[model samples]
Target: MAAIATDTHPYGRVSRLFHWGMAALFAWQFVTVGARVLLPDGALDDFLWPTHKPLGALLMLLVVLRLVWALVDRTRRPPSLNLAAHLGHLALYALMVAVPLVALMRQYGSGRAFSPFGIPLMSGFEGEIEWMTAIGGIFHGLLGWVLLALVVGHVGMAILHRRLSDENVLARMAPHAGQSR
Candidate 1:
């Protein structure tokens, strides 16, 4: 049981859970965004569009939890491959927190109620706050795209580490079936 939970050059179970779970959710986010950009008011976009805000809220919650878990388990986690990896991850975390926060600000500023997953987060206001909405409108989509690019770079670097440096970085987060440590 200790072995199952402890990191031995590989990520622990909880860390891997957060990593992979967030990866899937992020993938869905990208798909939804892609539909919005490429398909617009088409059927696919229409179907996926409604999920965008709610899922963003969920991702924000997960990211906050993941951040806290990472801090608590810092001593038990695998080390960054290098300075670049460390900075890249830091940027990813920053954007993960920033993107949804800006959106929430915009939602609130727009004088609209927001109830993601049916939990009332922001109540409707009588009038809009221009500055908050403007800031959110300007940065939210831009930062989201930047984060996606960084994620692509992150995955590429992991594969490059395996092929070029013989470092099985992905294995730390995604070990094979029946494999431990």
Candidate 2:
């Protein structure tokens, strides 16, 4: 497919879309969180909680999409790196998927049969275990900071590789030529 990055590899359109769209969603995560953390909890809390819950659930959906895309799409592989860097990528994906899921699970497992967005998941293992909520809750918020750090590192590396080293690291997953800025 001409949409592919090159002959042997390239991220699929849906993969690219999910990646970028999730970036916007993740940005909302940061904003929603800052709104909660910085602002005093009150009437605003209830309003923001609903918004945050849905945004988080959307993140879970996007992460699931990315996982599926990764499984199907043969993305262009980056140049060789040390074991640590490779492991870091693995860790990044793990955190990316788990972070949103843990948060969603905490909410649903804590008791919300349907997604706050209105789409009913209809499959949460609710009432299976009370500890799920406590653990998920702690990890959800804690790992959010970890996810943020990992993302920052991921972006920093991409920029460094692309701009400083003049590599095509980012263009691999970016929109097709002539489509984006």
Candidate 3:
């Protein structure tokens, strides 16, 4: 049998790495957020919640890199099986970018210095910008939850696609050694 090209096979190693790596990070992000919502000021919440901002910053960076990689690999990556799959992926990308951008705007506008991993991205200033902070306050958490919902839907659809149709959508992004395309 001829070896399958990445363009026609399941996702290449780089694409799978990006997919699963981001999935793991997102799972951690959700845990932190969940701890905050459920435990409030308790120990777990206190510890995990502090990590949220830094992790969000990291996720923002990763998502940007992933987006560029996806575009570069567009022709080589496995095609979306349907219109819903295409649109769902787009929504995920939109929310991923928006959530962090809004938070960073709020952080800057609050006149609070933010140094994720001590890089000193934003410096403190006097007085808050009401509009920017307001935008982040109103939309950040709300859209995050919306993104979570979409992620759930995305996973559900992937599983459903495998069970109901001929496509094994999950395998495209999952790691399976020595498996044929």
Candidate 4:
């Protein structure tokens, strides 16, 4: 086995920046969505929901950029755990890109008002796809759970690699200097 220490298989600076920034946005989304569903109306919550739609749009764009990066620089995955693990990772990436899209589609199809940075979208198609939006809402919920499960497994594997095995799993993702390991 190789030592995937804090310095091993260094992700490019763009990759690292996008990786962490996207992660923070994703966490924010989970909180935003959860609050929208679970909390009653309030000034704070009302203000927060608007952020969700735009942030989701930003997430979709970032997904495209991340895909391009992944293709151009096929990351040196810290040695495969197994075929299942690889497949699981593939699935997780697929859904992260897919779920938000369905939600965006729902916004368009349901005639719901949304703005990506206050620029309205889908106005031309309002009242055009009510049924599609209805279906999208259901699909969005399903995708959310799927994303959650995949994240749980990923986090668990990272913990196992660090605490049980001798691997430096978490460190591999921490901030690093240029080259001195």
All models: lDDT? 0.87, 0.69, 0.84, 0.74
lDDT of 2 by residue, 6-97 (tens): 22244566767887898888887877787788875766665665677778877777787787777676444433345866788788789888
TM-score of each: 0.92, 0.76, 0.91, 0.82
Write the residue-wise lDDT of candidate 4 on 45-72 in tens digits.
Answer: 7877778878888989898899888788
Q: Cα deviation of 1 in candidate 4 (Å)? A: 13
Clashing residue pairs in candidate 2 (N, C-alpha, C atoms within 3 angstroms): none
Measured on C-alpha atoms, candidate 3 has an lDDT of 0.84
**Model 1 agreement with the true structure over 7-64: per-residue lDDT tens digits:** 2378889989988998998899999999999999999999998999999999999999
Off by over 4 Å in 3: 1-8, 175-181
Q: Please, what are the lDDT tens digits per residue for candidate 3 over residues 22-125? A: 88888889999999989999999988988899989999999999999998989977777679888999999999999999999899989999999989989999
Clashes of each: 0, 0, 0, 0
Give stretches of model 4 more than 4 Å off: 1-7, 75-79, 175-181
Tell me the spans in candidate 1 whose CA falls farther than 4 Å from its real position: 1-8, 177-181
Which pairs of residues have clashing backbones in candidate 1? Answer: none
Output the worst ten-in-a-row residue range by lDDT, candidate 1: 1-10
How large an RMSD does model 2 have? 5.1
